[model samples]
Target: MSLYTTTLLILDPDPYNSIDRLYRRVIQQAMHVTLPTGCLDIFVARPPTRFRETHFVVAQLYKISAELKQLENKEDIDVRVLLEGVGGFDIGDARNRSWEVVAVGKSDSKLLPVFIAEQHSSWFSPALQIIILPMERSIETSSRLPSLPSDEDGSHPPTEEGPHLGEAGLVIDSTDEEGGDLDDEGEEAQYPIVALGGTFDHLHDGHKILLTMAGFLTGESLIIGVTGEALLQNKKYKEYLEPFPQRCAAVLNFLAYIYPALHATTDEINDVYGQSVTIEAIDALVISGETRQGAKLVNQERTRRGFHALKVWEIGVVNGDANDQWAGKLSSTDLRKREFEKGELAKGQGTQQKLE
Candidate 1:
């Protein structure tokens, strides 16, 4: 099969709720409609304000990609999760973020650009081939591209000279000849400081995946909020929870291993929001499914404090065993429970041997 690079823009509101179904659809589409193995850039356009929801979505996508690799026997499938800044979820923002994530230089020699969404939007470039899912129809045939805005004199602005159209219609130019520079042309625009918060206890596979994603999304630095001991006092399996300092150390170690070049800092958070709501430099916030509500609360606090809200990127819950009675994703609680059960079984076996 030919290698194809495609960027997918997901416009779903509750992507995590129907994760299994979404995964099936995505895999089916990838196998039948698009190339089975290539660079798949997935972007969730209107992610839930809650970090938990967003995290669930991301985790689901990660699981799906892994499953796809196993099923197709293609180990080289590159799947990247692209996140957008917090604000309006309009077509323009989605299109711009998509371009920003995939576009490297002025040329289109890398890969093919394809968009998949529930509905078609006019914000996409004319060169893009949009696929509307569930309906599974190409927007190129069903919808007409929107016309560019004209000046008061009814004349369209001159097209700025740039390099050849890239695979995903990425046009490279530092400055537009028509007037001012493009909004996303500066050095700072490429690398924005990002923040993420969690207890990060045990530092299992789930936490590792979340941290890995944060490292990827962050351009310059990653500010992590490890919940203080006081805040986690009421948590389940609190006795087994690692100390705040140890948790912080584990997080730092994991980040250093995955992203040796990234500048990562960890702080103790006593409250829910932490530095994400207070820090004005943070551009986005990475969250998992359990902390979704916390993200919304953080945004609310930011609004009250007259600070810009941080864009929240949610990751999905890692699925547990299929035969397990609990019908939810894998969690620290689950891990702890298994440990407790194993201890109890060991004790029972020792008692039986003594009696014998």
Candidate 2:
């Protein structure tokens, strides 16, 4: 039924007269829901002879909803409450924190009490109609098993950690005017959806480790975003690095055999700059929390451009190259600098599988 209609029915007089005593009124509103953790009492508005009684019930209801959701680990707990009077419910107390929705209507102050139940049930109407009834609570599973094997020295297994199948994603890095082909210039992305990014001027075992991770992450597609040469060089040495397309081609060749996504975009990735790319959508952006700042910047830009905020997931970093690779050793810029010349550029193929 429409919410307005339901509100009217709910506001109707109680089937049994309950004006004489407070005990009778309290019993009338004691609806309960059974959950795995405990039983939650749903409150219907009780006519309070005094204002203090109204305050007491409000405190009790908040405690109940908070306890229930805490057990479920659910963030989106909507509180469709009926306040005792208009302006009775405080927005601060009922917001995204413990509640996602609150539909309040007429009462003492044009407000009703909090929602009586969390679930709706289906029912039959007197006019020979199917009336869906509402419910309060239910028991549910909290944990699930992983899909991919965590062991090493095994064929790549599909994992939800990296990319999701058929999730549309895009990657953009400015390209020079090559071959003078407009269609070939800047195009939408394609899939096994590999997104190879970061400073490629020093593509080391860390890069390879990430490449291996991507192969497992996106089984059918990949997009290599070379982040313009200016952008990369600007990162450290303060100069344009690979001049864009060359970096793309280098990453492409190293990854071409394992990657299925053939397209790439420029700084315009995530539609912030406007040009669009085609390919599997990116379900998650896997990175070490080191890039947390950059990721947050990108996400903020996405929101400003009226796009969905990204669901960025952070992964732990593997140590040196040996660890980064199936060899299980540390491999990173710092380690590379300690061994080889600092800032020296290198490139090679990434592993085809996650190591032991």
Backbone clash count for every predicted candidate, in the order shown: 14, 58
Candidate 1, residues 1-356: lDDT per residue as tens digits? 33345544343424313445434455445534334555565545445443323444556556666676667776455555444333222333334433322221112112223232412355454445444435222112221112223467533343232111111111113333332222221222223798888888866656766786666567788999988967886888677777788999998876663355678899999999788877887887766656656777877787778887666655444654224632555467766676778888999999999999
**Cα error, candidate 1, residue 34 (Å):** 32
- The segments of candidate 1 whose C-alpha lies over 4 angstroms from its true place after superposition are 1-191, 320-326
Model 1: residue 187 alpha-carbon error in angstroms:
15
Best by lDDT: 1
Q: Lowest-lDDT window of 10 residues in candidate 1?
A: 162-171
- Candidate 1 at 236: error in angstroms? 2.2
TM-score of 2: 0.32
Residue 45 displacement (Å), model 1: 25
Worst 10 residues of 2 by lDDT: 164-173
